[model samples]
Target: MTNETKIPNTRWWRILPATVLVYIVANIDRANISFAMAGGMMEDLGLDAVAIGMAIGIFFWGYLLLQVPGGHLAERKSAKHFIAAMIVIWGGCATICGFISTSFEFNVVRFILGIAEGGIFPAILVIISHWFPPAERARANSIFLLSFPLSAIISGPISGWLIATWGWREMFIIEGVASIALIFLWMPLIADRPSKAKWLSAEERNWIESELAAEAAAKKAAAATNKSATKTSYRELVFDINLWKMVAVYFLICCAFYVLSFWLPTIIKDILKADIGMVGWLSALPNIAAALGIVFFGRMADKSQNRRKYCIIPYVCVGLCIIASVFTASYSGWLSFAFLCLCGFFWLSGHPVLWTIVAETFQPEVAGGARGAINALGNLSGFFAPMLLGYMIQNYSRDAGMYIFAVLVFLAAVIVWSMPKNAETKAAVEKTREHVAATTNAHA
Candidate 1:
């Protein structure tokens, strides 16, 4: 491995805390609601399963609307300021939840909170694409995203304890305060571009910048053979069949992951018939497994540089586990839990793999826009998945919801299987040249 690809660099040390720790705090803000639901937010608001689902999912609606704008904005200008502003807004919205008594009030703030958070991940992707070369990016994306499971590992029990002792309202208000405080850490530590990261040694900075420049040059060279590529607008990311294929797969992945994220505690509690606090700790096991998977799969992807295989494996695992969990839960609750833990383990791998494919496909200049487009579209699953599960649980059975999840994962696997490989991406670009030639001749 080259020096630049090594993980012992100053950049990982600097960027990991900004992305991972702050995201840990952000996850706390978003996820505390699950604890709150368990803590009696549902009873207080008189919300049924469907209402809970919509409340959980509506945030994505607002989140979805601004993703393109938020992503493109970060690409055009400064992610540092854009992310800072979003944290503050989401923090405020989380705080508002503590005071909200009505369902309307609750959903409204959650929706606004979604709008605030919509850009942050896309902006971070922009930042990563700039600072880390592709060789290190899967590792970077893995370690950075490892924070999601880490958040669950840490937040699950803490939220449970808080809800059990104090109440759900206090949990929201306190976590919101924590979210606001993290922005202070974010602003000082995060630099939008490598040149601004003065903490790095001069040599380190030069290496990162030069490596990224070389990758950009390579992309341009690959595109130059495609006559239409010269005229290819960044807007073309929207229409790229390959890009959309990735997005659809990610959507299914989100559906499975979020079901566990938003609903696992509730499901586990039904199986165990135990204390909420115990459920908190029990629910944490899957997240711990997921955290390990994120790092392990990310590093493996970086080392192997076999992006599509890694992506496909996780969805297949998730689908199998979804089917297995139905049988396991019928016999043993612990067996069902073990299946979910495995599901979480493989489920977390797809994300880092997906982002690595994107980083390898698009340049940093438009990388945020591409990430935003994919996430905006992909993340719509976050909205529908929860709502559908909620509907299924209320009308049919939780097993019925699992069936839907399995179906989604099956479709996701199909899409990932069809996605073009790296060499094929080049071929796809070359095909655009042929299309341009044929059109030119016809018009002439």
Candidate 2:
């Protein structure tokens, strides 16, 4: 766009493999508790549905509160440093959780894990914005995001194997040790930008800088024309109609997501009466489906440049699939599995849209804070989703819990659709195109 011609290289893809791999590890550690519960975790800990819900939901308690501050910090510091540090802290806490024999100790360790885990998403969002331009951001995000599904898919079987073979304690210990190893590996590999990385070619550096320079020029132009552009406070993002709408949409999605994370394995092992191995495998299926969905939809989002449609469509599909899942779970095994896969697929597709939209809405300077604010507020749903599902499951039936989930998903879909479509994004895109044309003409 800046008329800086540079050959595209494949070096960006290399960082992606390691980045996405650690991302997968992070999610796996976050999600492994669901699988652990299927083992003797619930029985030994003497946890009821409510207590279990609290345990899972508590991670978000600290996570929600720290998001904005973490975002601000991420903007100031290197994301690699933030991510590496948090990994160690959370991994250490997770390992200690394995040693906790009492419910109080378990809660304490989980709370610590929550605090350590809080900054990851916001930091990653900030990194994505810095690393890739709007044109490539969705695809880049999708690649890193591939870890979500991979984590989900792998967590069940891996945790199950560890739990069944070695014991659940060992699963935490092994995951923690692996996380520490990943931190060191990630250090030498990840850089804040291509310019900072010695391995990146000059062409690659120019390409990244050119993409960003165009964006900066556009923002400078906008700031000259609009008072809000020049004087807008980060806090104002909270009140902006579009930002709030996005937050509400994400809140609903988080509600559905955390519910599944907390309760899915338990439902399989307890309600469906599945064996431990079966529970692990079944739990992994939805995650695998979700992983596939992220890749497919993420690429599509980039190709089409239609973030809103991608965001809305998948959510509607997720709600429908959840409803179908509720009914199918009462039917044959194959039907149940099919519905879970469908539900997981659509549920997973919404994430790239969520983060990408935040990146698009704000300027790069405040993007981290914006992401943090959205995530912090939206994650409040994390507090309620699991606890509500737990209550429903305890008081009613698993069927009722699924019905409740379906309703929440539908509500989330509505919120996503209600977000005001900024014609500004399209305008910015057109301007970017025109600027590129002018620059090319001048260079020629």
Highest lDDT against the true fold, candidate: 1
Q: Write the per-residue lDDT of candidate 1 for residues 112-222, one digit (tens) a residue.
A: 999888888888888888787766789889988988999998988899998888999998988888888877799889998888877878778766765665566556766
Model 2: residues >4 Å from true position, as ranges? Answer: 1-6, 219-232, 270-272, 440-444
**lDDT of each model, Cα atoms only?**
0.81, 0.76
**Model 1 TM-score (2 dp):** 0.92
Worst 10 residues of 2 by lDDT: 223-232
Q: How many clashing residue pairs appear in each of the predictions shown?
A: 0, 0
Model 1 misplaced regions, further than 4 Å: 5-8, 224-232, 424-444
Inter-residue clash pairs, candidate 1: none
